[model samples]
Target: MSSVESVEEFRAEFRGWLRAHLTGGFADLRGRGGPGREHEAFAGRLAWERHMAEHGWTCVGWPVEYGGRGASTAQQIAFHEEYALADAPARVNHIGEQLLGPTLIAHGTDEQKRRFLPPVRAVEELWCQGYSEPDAGSDLAGVRTRAALRDGRWTVDGQKTWTSLAHEAQWCFVLARTTPGSRRHAGLSYLLVPMDQPGVQVRPITQLTGTSEFNEVFFDGARTDAAHVVGAPGDGWAVAMATLGYERGVSTLGQQVGFRRELEALAALARANGALADPLIADRLTRAWTGLQAMRAAALRPGTAPSTAKLYWARWHRDLGELAMDVCGAASLTAAGVHGDPYEPDDWQRLFLFSRADTLYAGSDEIQRNIVAERILGLPKEVRA
Candidate 1:
């Protein structure tokens, strides 16, 4: 088939599947699980994902031999966009399908691929990332997690903070200090560790939204097989960075779709509450619509577009959250339920609270500015303390 034909076919097929499947009990799952709302209908969502896997819909971007459709880039983006448009539940295995799966395909050994890819494609094994620490959130080079090779196993010891969905994950792809004296990004190894072992402790950190999607993971002598390391030992920074690159890849097209849905819903709320009469609110809404268009265009570009895209969407979403509150008027200040559920924020409240960290997490706005400055504009590097 021609490229255009294939993309059109892929989009049509995916849209049809979503319309057919997102019905009955699953119908209620629409627009439920994403970001801070990951705890919502998790089991149902996982079941939905496994159902997608059963129908060859999961991991469409992966090679056919690796249990994927070997879909073209355009096809993948089309799938994401259609999925979001259908209001499907947020995917539970996105970490596996989007990040680690591609990283393994690039850097992992054949044995590693054989052992891991099937479960990931099957949606049977969930994964989390272990990168940020108390000392190294954005400055990932400052990671202090240590892993030592002894007796054919890598024993890890350290804390990783802000680990998304670690409590629900069965495995974690970790970047740890493998050499004792190594500093910064050197001497790190990317190891896949099991999460169910006794040495791994997961403590959920409740966010301002009253949810615990973010977690603090303590690895006290946690161990993985020596063969679990991806790429050469003491050279994991490159592999880790590659995963970060994937984090900003085509899946973001889907994210923008979700963002568009949010904007539409916020606009409806404003119209219902007469908030659109306010010129300030109206202007912000118009700017938001234009910003989304700019984000879509930037995301289609190459190179530093990912960093720029992240900055654009994060700031835009955070402002949208603020706009949501303004649209809702005084109702945004109160919880949905009565005194017993005083902390149970409404959707707009949750959005505002959760989005406060959008600019701070992943890579902070400051870090992104530095990246654009030094890498894109050839600016001098920032001095470290």
Candidate 2:
């Protein structure tokens, strides 16, 4: 079949499946989890994800030999878009499925693929990324986490901050300094470390949303098998960059779908609260809609589109949160729940607060600009301290 025909068929089949399955308790999961609200219905979402794996829905973009459907890029985009339209629970395995899976496929050994791909595709083994350190958030190359080879294992020691879902993850793909004196991006090794070991400690960091989805993970002599390293021992910079590249791949189309839903809901809220009567409010809403369209268009472009798309949507969503607060006016100042209750932030409040970090994570806005300037635009490099 033609690519267009296949995408449409995949969309129809996926949409039908979602409608059929999103019933009973699962139906309530619509619009429940993502970003600031990843804590919502964790167990149910995990079960639901496993159910998707059972039905061959998870990892749709991976090769069929690796337990995926071997879907084309168009089909994968269709699945994500349809999933967002259905308001399905946010996927817990996205780190594994979208980021690490592709990286492993591209640079991992055949043994690594055979051992890791199946559990990830099955959604049975959840993974978290251990890239950012306390001192190296945007400057990933400055990571100080070190792993030493001893006997038949690698012993790791260091701390990783902003580790999303590290508390619940069974494993983490860590980029640690393997060579004793290596600086910057050199002498790094990307190793898959088990989270349940005695020396791994996870401390949840509560955010403005009153949730602890992100964590600070301390690895003190934590160990993984020597065979768990991806690529050559000292060439982790290349592997990690490949993983980052996968991080900006086609799954973002689904993210935009979610953004569209949020924008529409904000518009409806404005109408209900008589905020639309204000000319300024209405204009902002229109601009937000226009921005979303532009974002979609930019995302469709090739090459440096990922960096551009990330910069665009990060700023756009942050601004959308501001608009949401403006529309809500005085009501947004108070907690949505009981006054004495443990300060729960409603959806708008959560968006407003949590989105403040959009430009900081993954790659900071400054880092993204540097990437686009130095790499994409062929500009001179920024001076290093």
lDDT of 2 by residue, 1-385 (tens): 2233567888998999999998988888887778898988999999899989998899888877777788888798889999999989999999999998999898889999999999998888999999999899999999999999999999999999999999989999999999999999899999999999899999999998888989999999999999999999999999999998899888899999999999999999999999999999999999999999998888876654577778998999999999999999999998888445657878889899999999888789999999999989999999999
Which residue pairs in model 2 clash with each other?
A: none
State the lDDT of candidate 1 residue by residue for 30-49, as single tens digits. 88887778899999999999
All predictions: root-mean-square deviation over Cα?
Answer: 1.6, 1.6
All candidates' TM-scores? 0.97, 0.97
Candidates' C-alpha lDDT: 0.91, 0.91
lDDT of 2 at 360: 86
**Candidate 2, which segments miss by more than 4 Å at Cα?**
1-5, 338-342
